[model samples]
Target: MTDDQPEEWFRNSSSTAWGFLSAGAAIAIIVIDAATGWHPETTAGGVLFALVAYAAFFRTKVGVSEGDFVLHHLYSTVRFPMAALESVSVGRTLGAYAGGRTFVSGAVGRPLREAVKGAKREHKPLSNHADFVEDRLNGLAQDARDRRGIKRDSDEQFALAEDVRRSWDWPLIGATLVVAVVFAVLLVL
Candidate 1:
């Protein structure tokens, strides 16, 4: 049996673009804060945080390749045979606030789910990262079914994925832009 080692895949263009934009925005914020010279320390921290966050997001690995195709998100790193992959598809309508920062909310799988649930239990509303990761994985499985010419339970999964992708992106972008704009406006004011 051949080893199914993962090859590094290039980051998505859109993801990279967003990363730069966010980094630029963060830098801008820091600069503006510095120019005003009121709260230099706070402004510097904000800039550093944004830049670091941006680096963590797009500069980091978005997907990993194994043999035929690439698996996206951190979950792609999970130990599983290629056979375990059900499908590979881009996640659903992403919420904007999370989009420029990430594809899925957290590292994929059960640990993420537990963290999300834990946050919710603690009254900290969490993003739908795990669900999105699951959706993408299901899509991959569905694609596999299609490719193998196998009639499996992927039909519903595909349909759901379609819905998620369509509904998620715009709102996510909109929300992020809205927040960013609000911050800009506040700064201006």
Candidate 2:
């Protein structure tokens, strides 16, 4: 890393609220179970639920570094080289498409939308931070493409982006489901 190297940009919008809430809920459940003589299984299930919530919602980081788009989730990370990136699409969240992979940012953009709605309800205008992030991500993607090469056709890029968007996070989803099922079983028995 040097001054000439592009600075990394990172976003983890759910850390403050989601992280604290999940942690607090976990701790509270454990404490209450201990004091009230709840079954140990119930405590364990509550803790596991808290862990799942923290992992899925709180422990996420999305960024661009070293000419790669990075998505950091609870137990995995996916990276896509900027050279391979076709474009970025942002809606309720941010996504970078490259090499048939989509790197999605955690929870973002929603706060900006809520702020905008609040302002509108109060008859005031609101500054949108999501737009700034979208612009920055788009600029980085373009810069990456330019640095890599400019020979790619628009149709090819579009196809690749679509493929990336459609790709699913099967591992994480599966693990979460397993945890939920186990927790349910523990509660029932």
Highest TM-score scorer: 2
Per-model tally of clashing residue pairs = 15, 0
Q: In model 1, which runs have C-alpha deviations exceeding 4 angstroms?
A: 1-10, 38-41, 48-56, 59-62, 65-79, 91-189
Query: What is the C-alpha lDDT profile of model 2 across 1-189, one tens digit per residue?
Result: 111227565554555577788878888988898899877676767767776776767656666766556676666766655445666655566666665555676544445555456435332113544556666666776776565544444654544344222235566667667767777887788
Please report how far candidate 1 places residue 142 from its true position, in Å: 12
Write model 1 residue lDDT over 1-189, tens digit each, in one string.
113434434344455666777778878877787788756455645655574555445534333344222323321222232223434323222211111222342222334345455435322113544444445445544454455554543453233223212112344345445556555665666
lDDT over C-alpha atoms for residue 82 of model 2: 49
- Minimum summed lDDT over a 10-residue window in model 2 is located at 118-127
lDDT of 2: 0.61
Native-to-model Cα distance after best TM-score fit, residue 79 in candidate 2, in Å: 2.0
The TM-score of predicted model 2 comes to 0.65
